[model samples]
Target: MRTTTAPGDALGVLETAALLRELTAGLISAADFDEALAQLVRTCRAAVPGVTWCSVTILQAGEPASVAASDEPIRALDDVQYGDDGPAITAIRERDPVFVPDLAGSGRWPRWTARALALGVHGVVSAPVDIDDQVIGSINLYARRPGAFRDRQQLTAMLLAEHAGLLLAAVRGRVRADRAQPQPVAPGDEEVVGHALGVIMTQRGCPAPEAREVLRGASRALSIPLAELARRLVDSVARHHPG
Candidate 1:
């Protein structure tokens, strides 16, 4: 819950605590709660000095995608979707944190390591973001220098990941409550599900039927109920289009 710095460093425990409080307050009060996730990664970059880049990787239907990144270069995380050997993948799959103090010297994930090295990333840490014992994603931190991340930085990242998880859970809860409310002819559930399907259709450039099918596929792959998956998708859309 605290981060330390050298005597003259600009950041310290007080600053870190203030950042955490700000993030928590924003997530709790924001009308569009999902947008708070993007803020989470940005906060990570600011709170941790060794973090050169930050990204949030969301796992849906057994597929992982980077939903928010601090910089354009960090978008290379999309490539990680192709393989299962990267730090983020490991973190989510194992429900644990993975830290590569020196990406270039690490023996694991040769392909991902090479790609990260090419991007001037020499160290990385990934922490699982979970809710109710289920790991839904990870927060990945990248550094430009070897051994850039130490135990303190890892602890800070983990704390941020915990906050991110709490925010996501809250969003999901809201969506579920909205869907559960009583309604006339067209139930709230169906309405929200339809909206979610339309969102998928637009984002994936597909038709309504195809988007519904995509949702079903993801639901089955991730072992999440269709309605729950729909809620998550709707939440995601709301985050991007807060207006």
Candidate 2:
């Protein structure tokens, strides 16, 4: 199926360049890289005309997980990850952009197509976020209408994904260097944080980075320290989903 954008519906090259500049600036000034990733998804949703939602799927430590999503009801991403056949996974695996113009007629990953349709997502475009030769993750955009993403939209998404990949690479490098230095943590706090991350991973079916971001968000919302919030979450999970 062919898709076209109205004259005003698509961003001009100059506008696109300005938006990318803003994103790059934001990434440079962001206090936390994970939070920046969350912001990146939100920016993607705003920059793309037909995008109803956006998410970032990172493959780190041999685990693939949706680390940031613009919407809360992103359970479909989990299905894609589990099935290993959706556009997001394919984009990262192949290190290329994957566009599903019409999910209903795609004839690929039937389960994922059904789930996405049920979730009101009919179109998708996923672009691999790469750093050098490494495929770090993917930037996935979803649309509510079939064939919503046209070539222009795909190109914009690809550009954004490339910018995100560069930022991620810098952030990962900084984190690795930090890890080499001595850091202090309160007694038992690390364990509590780990347990809380695990609980979030189990409950949300997201990756470790995503779970950590969730914890950080909760901490900010509740005006509590991260360790304390983690402790609370661990206790709550134990009470509810006791193993």
Candidate 3:
């Protein structure tokens, strides 16, 4: 992890809260661990100014895997990291946040940096997802311009990565529960599904039945149970905008 000491203004209280609100909403609405991480990367890419790409790496059964990315091109960048040492791998190993203000002169990870430069990535920030003293993975953010992620942006990335740890912990709990017993959608689950349908209708500009199909399609695509997906959507909206 690269450390820096620079004078800069921190994010405002309300501003930080707003950003966190978006992330928390994403977690609440996600159908499972993978979707939650996907939401995190998407939110970080859009919310963090100057971030061109974002990706999440998690250790799946002791093997590193790039779980989510902001765009397709980011997979290539992540692949380079998986092949050799990169900021993300370093962050996970050190259990700290790493900021590469400029990859042009970086000798720390030559091969990976060269690949990143060729891909038009000039800067990088990797924050470790440390949960209960265990490093689960990392969140990598890339920029097209050097020095794009300063103190403020690095702090934001670190905070979000910390939230990813919490999400992982929740996922572990859910997995344990899932293994304990199969949860069947109850009668009340229909209402949850209805709310999810309404959300899909608005997002897709489709009718109720069409939205229902959309939910069904997503459930099938993600291999998630229909009832579970519906509950996640409703929870995402309800928690984000409580009455």
Candidate 4:
């Protein structure tokens, strides 16, 4: 989303690999698609030096919405694009990556440009996360200055999208299976749940009792085994509040 003005820098091989490593490790214990996406946004914001904010748009059943956004302006910009038919929407619907070097001067998303300009955002690099041309979502990176992400950076972003696609498929697969029959806690659940609860305690400022109650509620609502439910709840919260 919109942030302070800055220029894009070229990333080296080592840097790129390091970013990939960090991103993968970040989502290792993620519970599902949403959790992974939340981490995806966090990872991009960290890896990209000038990226003061980030946002993601998940298109589910033809409706697109912000799954994770760093700020209100960023989320609102994405929401505007998602609501109408434009290049970003076309790129997503057509399963192609859309790169807008300049948002303010571009007429592609005329309304989007005005809105983005109002909030100080002036560029975008959108990478569609698609599975065999069936786009499930898109990662939209915005910047306050124009001509943000470059061509090679766009390629690296595609790598992120590829990993994200696989991550989502794996997580959603588990969710479907879990939904069919309640899931049981694996050995790693303790750590997963701990991390999740830590995020909730920090973000929501809830006490242990309330956090534990939240875990219990998630378990009952999802019909998951108690421990598994706790782990999932914690993992979900952690991903969105990694800061």
Which candidate leads in lDDT? 3
List per-prediction Cα lDDT, in the order shown: 0.75, 0.77, 0.80, 0.70
Runs in model 4 deviating more than 4 A are 1-11, 131-135, 183-243
Q: Give the better candidate number (3 or 4) by TM-score.
A: 3
Q: State the displacement of the C-alpha of residue 42, model 3, in Å, after optimal TM-score superposition.
A: 0.7
- lDDT for 106 (candidate 4): 76
Provide the RMSD of all predictions against the true structure, rounded to 1 decimal: 11.6, 11.4, 13.4, 13.1
Every model's TM-score: 0.65, 0.67, 0.70, 0.67
- State the lDDT of candidate 2 residue by residue for 18-115, as single tens digits: 88987887776666667778778878888778899888887765466446888677644644665557777788778888888788888987777777
A best-first ranking of the candidates according to their lDDT comes to: 3, 2, 1, 4
How does candidate 3 score on lDDT? Answer: 0.80
Worst 10 residues of 2 by lDDT: 176-185
Off by over 4 Å in 3: 1-8, 132-135, 183-243
Q: Distance (Å) between predicted and true CA of 155, model 4?
A: 1.8
Q: What's the true lDDT of residue 121 in model 2?
A: 88
Model 4, 1-243: lDDT tens digits are 222322444557898889888887877668866787788898987777545567777776676644588887777667777666654576677777777767766778677777777888776777778733333887777777776656654666667888877766777677667655534556767677667667668768998778766766666576667676666666666587696
Model 4 reaches what TM-score against the true structure? 0.67
Which sections of candidate 2 miss by over 4 Å? 1-11, 132-135, 179-243
